[model samples]
Target: MQHRFLLGTRKGLFVVERTVHGWRSLPPHFPGLQIPAVLTDPRDGAWYAVVHHGHFGTKLHRSADSGRTWTEIASPAFPPKPADAPDIRCPMRGVTIPWSVELAWCLEAGGDDQTGRLWCGTVPGGLFKSDDHGDSWSLVTGLWNRPERAKWFGGGYDYPGIHSILVDPRDPTRLGVGVSCGGYWVSEDDGATWANRSDGMRAAYLPPDQADDPDTQDPHRISRCLAEPDVLWCQHHNGIFRSTDDGLSWKAVPPPEPSGFGFAVAAHPIDPETALFAPAEADVCRIPKAGRFVLTRTRDGGKGFETLTRGLPLDEAYDLVYRHGIDTDATGNRVAVGSTSGGVWVSEDGGDGWMPLPVRFPPVLTVRFV
Candidate 1:
């Protein structure tokens, strides 16, 4: 069977189809702007893409009939501004010409029903919720206005800037959001309130000299996997951790190998005992050393790991994978990785062997198979 892949590109949105030979990219979905997130709903057969409009703010486009035609969903919660406002990032200078939406990104379409809810996260970020699909939205008051957050996470440098929003696939009311320096937060009552899940996380306030620069060190990142509501696979700069009692507590899972500068973590759709990740340097340039790419899987609940590098390119010495870019298919038999060097590799035999797809996508920012 052939599959359609929705690509959120730097310039615009594109669709890729699996042909008899390989994948092919279609024309741009919209005129200009970067598409940071795209969702292909298997249930309703709708396509939704979020566009970053620099300072002008963000836009959402939806197609009930696939990519044949489109319509824009004017953001309902976007803080209204004067006609010639500055930008989304800097809204003071009356900057008319739009600026590059500097990563004030959003991850849309979450919740149990998977049709009515969509969550958006932004830089200096605030959490916004939309229950009517993308028609309108409202800020999650508790998360957006945490009293102690400004002091706890540092207002300027350590403040919250969201990158990922995960709602329990099994129970959409329970929500989780991943922030840059603030770490992770969880909401049990459908985002009515949030609690920090960084208890086991290292919140080291490093001095300039003592700091492990994200560029040189592991960037002290945090990523999560929710294969089960009670069990979450979390990866941090220091090590890998597992939360058995939801996000309330955590236990450190021994690194599969010596190298643990992990960027992403993915749990198989059905196989709870199985998950995958890519290893890289902890510092600024987290490239794989000499294309030494390996897909590490833990079969016995992080007790032991097996490496799958069968068809992965071994020529380059360093093969690095970044955070938020690895994913598993519905059957869990196939896996794909997007590299900083702009490489895409797919494994159909459960990560034992990989097939290099035909398209050379831009340095892959994220990969999702649905």
Candidate 2:
């Protein structure tokens, strides 16, 4: 399949396509603006971009003509804290968790059965659902109102955020969310109720006695297989984990080469036992291991990994792929990855090899195939 990409970068959002002559980039949208999240609705070809303003806060924009123009829409907002509600504080920074949206970290379209529906995951751990496209949004209190949220502290940011939202293909009401330092949560009634499901995910950052606590485990990113809905893969803070039962529980995959300590995991579209990862130095050092950047793929459910580095930086490399920086096309044959260093690469054969894309860019925050 011909591949097109939506690269949400620190400077703006870019739409690029692979064509007969060469890869071509369309005029960028929201130039020089930090676009942290973006979504291209497969349902109607509508595109959505989330912009973060240094002084004005977060905003959402939608484009129906493929980025030719955009219209601003309502961004997600936390309901005013109840007048009598108890104070909730962040454990990491020792600050009160504000009832506001700092950033819209991720966005996804609802299943086909739910027309005009959209799901937006925001920082401060709020999930918002929109029924009229981006016209309006209502906070999903099922996951938010849980008492466990009080313990959800920051992982990399001062406030915890929900960066991954997985909607089951077979059941529209069944949703899975991945929160940094908040653990994984599942809802079965369309965001009316939720259950923490990060059992077996370890947290090395915590004391040994609390290392296995489900409520505090940080999942850098979680992705489900498009062809096998129940299977999911996670690149966690402490290590790599896999969920064979729709994320109700997880089992750590044996450590892969270089390191298993990075963000970005892409489950193969057709193979439940296959997925891709970008490994990096963890904790204090978040760059590529030993100054070499590479991609790892597992064909047998992480039993082992084969590192792919055909076109990647192998010396003095400092690229780090964010949680949303890598993606795979529907056929699982084409893969794309962007990094903090503004480097982009594409693999046309299941990551067997890669080639750099011809473009200079700002740090890429998120990349999604369109």
Candidate 3:
């Protein structure tokens, strides 16, 4: 297993390390803060944490020394609402979407050539970009100004949020985005413009006739194969989907057994055909199937999947993995699983077996192997 992994939890940020003795936790950094998003930018070896302070609003912190030291940086924010701008109501809750940052849902760095470039997705359906290493951020108004945003409602949040951003490795300008209840979008011109490209992903949560509407699909999460950026895996609200042509069109794959409803999915670093999913019940029942903790892996795209349960719980386990709760190292052999139930586990040899890191964390939201 890798020597270290970062844990972003409901209560704070923790850097878990493996030592000669055992798993050693460097003192918790944001002790009482809620870390909603984290990013270990491979571009510059810097760590970024997006924290939420109930009354203080959302803030961004960067650690350049591998969690040893930290610095406060400017967080993503929306410009003041124009007095003449029309008020928009959330389609799901019928409440006006606030022109403020509710939560920083995701963080991703730009391509290797684009240093100091970062992307952030937030609740209320806004995308922000930073050009000076978090010194300042500007909302990507292209996506925010889209009319489809009015059709986008919440997934788990009251207002819709963008949780996944895929920066294509081949071309820094090419991008793929995943939103809860807002459908999939792609931009080939570096986010200056966008297009809804979720052609085949169906949303069983909607009326049968409108289930395939591209503008209202709810994709729980999406992962892109680093080795094959054209291939993308989507864990949708209805089922699992795959795209072989840069997310232009999606194909429904065999939903992994026990269930296909899950939020977390991990793609192999080197293999486009390989991926893993954390299975759960359905929308109302989000726990593991029959209280048995397991993960489904497919090495042959989505043609087939195998259940893995060697070192996971089998009875009375009720861990629910969030969209960003599971992650894979560069090699893809080392995998990490963090759950909302406060349990974290690692698998050194793919999904063969697991080793539980001895720590009681506050609901783990995101796990990143740095």
Candidate 4:
């Protein structure tokens, strides 16, 4: 079977197909909108894309017949400001938190049998749920009303966002979400309620006393081991983390080498012990360490990591991989990565080797294999 890739880019979305001969890039889809997230639901072959338009706002599109056509669906939005609701304030910074729905930062489909269920994470840090595909959405008020939200801050944007959503394949009601600067949260009874699972995680920017504060921990990205749903991995702002009991608690994993900061993390589909990360310089720099592009892989959970750079640029190359810009196939042997510089690479035999897909599209935001 030919491996297919759906690349969400800053300018649009592109589909790249890989066969025995090599990789081929197909035409772009949703030509001018910035696509921050895209997902092709294998259960029913439904495609969903999150489009961000600077002038108009964020919108969701659904494609029933692959990417050949699409239909605009109800975009997720914040509830109307309550007349008696008080202004949100940031407890740590002593400032009023600007509350508004900016964009859909992440899109995740529900379980294989739950066709109409969809979960979306948005800027200003709100989680929304849709039971009819993308037709309409309702704010997950349980999480939105959490008291800890007063402490969540933005890591890169003006406000924090739920950029990673993981729906446990074994239970349709179980869900996990990773927020930038807000940390991690897990729900056992669907979106009815959430619990902060940032314990043991650290935030370097904070003082020593507040380093382990759950609300202050910034998780750049989080992924779960497909073969072992209880095992979770996170590329944290300060370092890497892993959780064996779902997201109840996280343990810091020694970051591999040059720098520990990064925004993307991926787990092998069939191996709970294997994971991938693209380390970059500190947040201030946001560039590859030493100007070299390399991917660090860990075969024994986070015990140790090996830097893979066989076919990657060695010098003067600074490519940043976003939180959703890396993914692996079902076999766990095929991995694909897209960078902010529009660079795309694939590793066929795990992370031991690599090959570049002959296409430089827009600044890549997310990449997925179907």
Residues 1-370 of candidate 2 have per-residue lDDT tens digits of: 6479899999989988988875666777898898988998989999999998878999999999988889999999878889887778997677999788988999999998899899999888999999999899999987888999998988767789999999988988898999998999999999999999999899988889999889999999999998889899999998899999988789999988889999999999899989999999766689888899998999999899998888786689799999999888889888889999988898888899888877878999999898
Model 2 — TM-score against the truth?
Answer: 0.98
Off by over 4 Å in 3: none
Clashing pairs in 2: none
Assess each prediction's global lDDT (C-alpha) against the native: 0.62, 0.90, 0.90, 0.87
Candidates ranked by TM-score:
2, 3, 4, 1
> Residue 32 error for model 2, in Å?
0.6
Model 1, which residues run further than 4 Å from truth? 27-33, 54-57, 76-104, 112-115, 151-159, 203-227, 317-320
The candidate that wins on TM-score is 2
Worst 10 residues of 2 by lDDT: 19-28
In terms of lDDT, which candidate is stronger, 1 or 3? 3
lDDT for each residue of candidate 4 in 139-249, tens digit (9 for 90 to 100): 999999998888888776777789999999899799989988788998999989899988889887998888888987889999999889999999998889999989888
- For model 3, how big is the CA root-mean-square deviation? 1.2
Please give the lDDT score at residue 302 for candidate 1: 85
Better of 3 and 4 by TM-score: 3
lDDT of 1 at 342: 55
Q: Is candidate 1 or candidate 4 better by TM-score?
A: 4
- Return the lDDT, model 2, position 305: 95
* Residue 280 lDDT in candidate 2: 92
